[model samples]
Target chain A: MQADYVNPIFKAANDVFNSMLQLEVSRGDLETNDNLVSTKEANISIGVTGDLNGSILFSFPEDMVLDIVEGMSGMEMKEIDTFVTSAMGELANIICGNALTTLNENNYNCDIVPPQVLIGKGQTVAMSTEQVLTINLETDIGEFDLNISIS
Target chain B: MIWKERYKIGVEEVDRQHKELFNRLNDFLQVVRSEEDMEKKAAEIEKTLNFMGEYVVVHFDSEEEIQREYNYPDYEEHRQTHERFKQEIMEFKQEFEADKCNEELVMEFSGKLLTWLIHHVAGADQKIGEYVDNN
Candidate 1:
């Protein structure tokens, strides 16, 4: 994907984290990884259709996931259960939806499907020739990765 | 308690409704997370779910009216977002009626509700505020 396409996703992530979770986020340089294996425990995959036909994968470590849920709900969560996973999926959905809005404003005209949450570690995602633009985001709660693979 | 002033979208009516929505969700979250028996928690969930079903429609209607008055460019898209959430809640209510004591479904619903509210109010609804300020 073009470098310009990545900006909207980054901006959306930053805005959501800052506004929703009240967390400031700093993103690292965007790098491409051909073989994308998620080392994090929680993965939320959001599918994009219309002008762009691919998926955006949000990978969060176990602690980061727990921290986010606790931050949003003001409760202590010790494990990645259905409640935690669903919250992560919805967060990913909101971020993707906002990014799509930005893309539409730029005349991209795309829509996002419901997010699917996968809970596990060391899961390898097969991209099948799609270039994955991975970016590491640092936050006070923890660190997470945004893997964008959209054409 | 989850309702923060930062979620205000600069519109009085919509902001009030948003706060109410957050309060209701926060109430539900509190009950769900409490150390209560399943029956007690289920009863509270049912009450909140019913209130959410009716109040959400009212809130969305008011917000949409404001969007139309401002000639908000994204009115249709924003309404669709509201509609999708309404549909999901409706489905959840149906499942809840069929199995009133399903703690798992209630937990999932609570989690999704909290996340969706925070993001929509702080992220999507903020754009409406920006548009009004700009125009």
Candidate 2:
């Protein structure tokens, strides 16, 4: 993620969580996530369009995904499955949509494709094994990571 | 969720339709998410989707008339959003009618409907209020 992408996406997360979920979240410094794999992470990838054509990957730990689903839906997301994955993907989509709106006002006309849940622990994003940008978003129950690459 | 007074723009006709829209969508969501029998749920779910298809066009037409009355600066983009969503919902309902047993698509449509309503109200429609205030 570039600084622009990182900051705006983080700002979007903050605004959305605060307004929609009424949850205050904090983020740590941007770190590298070269070894991150979706097979091990409960993440959703949403594609972007217009000025930005890429995929924003939100990598969450299984426990954190459950925590988020529980927090958002007021129900128990006992395990990571289609229901849980779809819910989380919708969250990511909301965040991305909010971010796109902000970016649009900043002269970045962007839209997003629907969100897709990457299941299992073997599929990879096939990015260069470099120090990709990531932020550890700490919430009350758990934390999540936001990873992005513009293709 | 029901449309609140704060959601109104002081426009009689448009505001009334928006309220009806929120009520219909909220009712649809309630029934769709009900913890009820799957066999018995199909009728009500199908009904809501069919209603949404019609209500959206009527609601958008009424709101757009108000938008034109006020010369809404963002009318084009706003109408575009409505158009795209209407098309998507139509597609979703068409798919549901084709395969009534596809639980996955129904759930996906439900989730999208929930999120879309909240954002459209809290974010997009809120701007109409801003326009109303300024003009």
Candidate 3:
């Protein structure tokens, strides 16, 4: 059940990144690093719940975040403020939304929350981690850490 | 995941290939994004890069061939899109070798490709699917 739920989401994320961003990405191991920390300029997170629940967080250094947003919107995203964060959040949302559809096909009825953009230092969200799986993605643009845990 | 019934765009051969293309992309991405060693992941990335460059071109060509067969109204527009992709792929190949640190370019490219394919299939190419359905 966990395999079915997470694999598709990971695949869809790769596909979206491949097609939408044109950067080839590979998954990282399900590392158990709860105290995971990043000094990257921006991190956008979205929540998943019911039957399967956790969070997908996309982290990027300042320039990388702007580059991603600029490409998606076809406009220059100069700063790591509200508008840029919202745009980045939407990309995460789209990936999760597609992943949910993939999950539904495999018999897991799950839904997702609106994506949230976290700003500044000390923005930490905890997960059950007891049975969590992290779909870490290493890409040319940056890295996306997808942590999935069943509640 | 094999191409299910839902993604069909009506044209027989092209539809078959489209499903195959999606499956290949999925497989390629899975390998690329695998939580393995960096060397292993980079190996897969290099391998899949070839597939995307060569295979995607072939796929796009075949798709265009089908469009031509049916006299697709947006043929010129579609062709231009393909041309742009081809050019960008070449540029990426060069940049990839020259600049290892510039992964941002790669990420941006992937995002654009993902969004473009969905809209192209669901919006532009779907017209052909509609035509085949109607005819």
Q: Which regions of candidate 3 are displaced past 4 Å?
A: A35-39, B1-135
Q: What TM-score should be assigned to candidate 2?
A: 0.78
Tell me the tens digit of each residue's lDDT in model 3 across B1-135.
Answer: 423455567788777777666666555545533446644465566677777678778888998887787787878988997898789778877876675444444444454454445545544566778865665
Across residues B1-135, which tens digit of lDDT does each residue of candidate 2 receive?
345565566667767877788777767766666777756787888998778668889988888887888899999999999999998898887898888776667777776665566567666777787787789
TM-score for all models, in order of appearance:
0.85, 0.78, 0.52
Candidate 1 runs further than 4 Å off:
A29-34, A49-52, A104-111, B37-40, B68-73, B130-135
Write down the worst ten-residue block by lDDT for model 3 chain B: B100-109
- Give the best candidate by lDDT: 1
Regions more than 4 Å wrong, model 2? A22-25, A38-42, A48-54, A60-84, A98-113, A119-123, A139-142, B1-19, B35-37
Per-residue lDDT tens digits of candidate 1, residues A98-118?
888899998898999898877
How much is the lDDT of residue A54 in candidate 2? Answer: 69
Docking class of 3: incorrect
TM-score ranking from best candidate downward? 1, 2, 3
Give the CA lDDT, 0 to 100, for residue A27 in model 1: 85
Model 1 chain B: ten consecutive residues of lowest lDDT: B26-35
For candidate 1, the per-residue lDDT at A7 reads: 82
Show how many residue pairs clash in every candidate, following the order shown: 0, 2, 27
lDDT at position A97, candidate 1: 80
Write down the worst ten-residue block by lDDT for model 2 chain B: B1-10
